[model samples]
Target: MKDIQSLPPGPKPHPFFGNLLEFQRDQLKFVERMQRTYGDMVTMHAGPRPFVLLFRPEYVRYLLTEHPRDFMATQSAGGDLMEVLGESLLTIEGEAHRQQRRLVQPAFHKKRVESYADYMVQYTQEMLDTWHEGEVVDIAQAMQQLTLRIVVRSLFALELLDQIDEMGRNFSQMIEHRRSLLARLLNIYVDLPFTLYGKRMSAKRRIDAFIYKLIRERKAEGQDHGDVLSMLLATQDEEHPLSEQQIRDHVITFMAAGHETTANALNWTFYLLAQNPEPREKLLQELQTVLAGRTPTLNDLPNLPYTEWVINESMRVYPPVWAMGRKSLVPFEMGGYHFPEGMTFLFSQWVIHHHPDLWQDPNTFRPERWNPENDEKVQPWSYFPFGGGPRICIGMPFAQLEAKLLLATIMQRYTPRLIPGFPVVPKPRVTLRLKHGLRMKVERTATVVKDSVTMI
Candidate 1:
């Protein structure tokens, strides 16, 4: 082991708390301040538990890809999340993670995910139908609900679509409670009314009951529903079949993972487009030309490079998964520095996305940087919005398709204009989101063809 005092330079510790209070106050701003003050790397503590912050792309790549096993994904909540989520991909590790990834990989394959294109377009349209033209809408809230419905319909089919309202309310209460002080202490084990832990368990029970009911119905029907549920249930011929608990865990995990990230991605994409007029116009032009006043489908993606660019750049600017860290299992050396074992070492997408050296004019929303002609100029791990390495998000293909189609569908008919004087800031909890919901004024346009349908 190396000397603790020899670690990289960082902001002065605040006696007992170190940087914990500052970190808990506003992590994004703290990270930016650290980056400016300490350059590429910093060593600080969260109440005496010191961690390293690697803001450079080179360091991030080594930690995530080259020597991934040297670090473990979860630092503090490994046991906690596993208790709630089971041995699902997010919780599992080593060979177990590999096997689960293999089992779930096929469902998200490009060709397989494209089959759900019609569902994406249809569900998005259903959402837009509820919005009155020129109404002030909270785009963030709207996208969350829209993506939630899409997750249900696309992954499990329409059997549960009608129950979305009740489910959403229940889920909201549960998630909000999960963030409370009492719930964090209980950590998913405790149950019963008067406490936060109890409320969370109740929420989980409601959610679990709903999930188990879906599983029972799917198994009863015994017919393929052409969704994720059907795929998971079709393991009859396999030597190793998923247990009831395993299936339930996976369904709940996907429900939590799939919709939330995509919702934020869509939310930030619209926010970026609204703030930057030139790219917004460019995206609109590309949509009009390629889509020809029709809703977009997965097949039409290649022709809409600018649309893809916009989403990519938007994620680069405001990544949904803003930061992630791993606990160092063993000591390591790189760039003439030591990473002590048993300490948490973390990196932020926000830090890398805006790194001065890695990105030119990193603050600007320049979709053109993603153009093929300039592709080689970017280094790996510099713009990882959905994570990287073996544990990269399994739903990447599905999410990209969903975002593009949703963008084309909505932009084809209306442009969501941000309401003036509404302060926009990110609340980077679990996922990066608007501090106050994104308020937008929806203005309908004649760009869409009323009879148009997405071409298969």
Candidate 2:
């Protein structure tokens, strides 16, 4: 074991700014380089704050599962997230987090999440209807719009359907602002309309107002709509029911997280399939045999194994929530090294997913890697697209179901081909997004088997 006081190896930091400039220039490359040069445990700094980047799968399992109490989820951009997400489950910790998670858990229960499948297919089909065979479309924007609609419908019922476009715009602005380097470095709080911080604040207020209005309307109706919002409003602890603010916090958290990650996941999936024709063909074959051009239901998921693998592989290559961070609540030792209190640990799914030690051809798009017959058994914490352990994404079931249904529904009608020479770059943001958006030409599938195939 290494000395408890010894710090991990990493690139030397520039005084004052530390490694902030290097990190800001390109976070993905920086993290990958650190792991390659310094091995599993790498230390760096963001301004004055020192952080340790853990690269091994065992390290991931330890922080997230084995000794979860030693750390807490670090706030985004230093409390900028809390300003937007409020005291929602994403930001809180300890018993309060447990209680809130308990109250909100039922909304994401397997049965409840499965109930949204029809809506998922319907919205996707509706989006597909707008595409013409020869038209060029931004697939990233399209996925974002479709998921925003599905999440709103599932969360608030159809009440927010009409406001989807406006809500989407505001949400987009909020995300851009949150991820903006200028916003993070400057910590500008000027409330003027011209400032970046001001504009994001405005967007937050608009969203808050819209949600508050809906909450009031729902409370007045006093009827369960069988949507997540209704479920949350009714759930309570022994002391009292969830207040409107608390419910709004959860709503905003769900709205932002619920759609953003899934949208990017689909964007990357389509891009991967377009690039790798064999997997694409296999996926199409699976859809053709299993779905047979029919809308996929939750029950159909069992038969669509290749579809799941494609998504799994895509996430492994380009995880939506690419990185996660945690702050030490107390001094701890791991990987034979010790950390001080308030130390931050950053781990990247992108790096781990692409780690040479963990995966073969780590950068290649290979859905077959997930096949049980492949002979390479994936260890625990080896692939966590939706995260892991107790605080794993509550919406994992919902996001998976939505992605599968949407992919099946769209592939049955249209095959999106990436435009030739179109540059697709991954932007490390609140999620892994295409920096320039995914521009693709829509081509109608010629051989979509219409006759339903019997499930074997």
Please tell me which predicted candidate would have the highest TM-score against the true structure: 2
Clashing pairs in 1: none
> Candidate 2 — worst ten consecutive residues by lDDT sum?
447-456
lDDT of each candidate versus the true structure: 0.79, 0.85
Candidate 2: the clashing residue pairs are none
User: Across residues 362-408, which tens digit of lDDT does each residue of candidate 1 receive?
Assistant: 99999999998875477887989887898888888878888899988
Q: Once superposed on the true structure, which residue ranges of model 1 sit more than 4 Å away at CA?
A: 75-80, 179-198, 236-240, 374-376, 446-456
Report per-prediction Cα RMSD to one decimal.
3.8, 3.2
| TM, every model | 0.91, 0.95
RMSD of 1: 3.8
For model 1, state the Cα shift of residue 162 in Å.
3.4
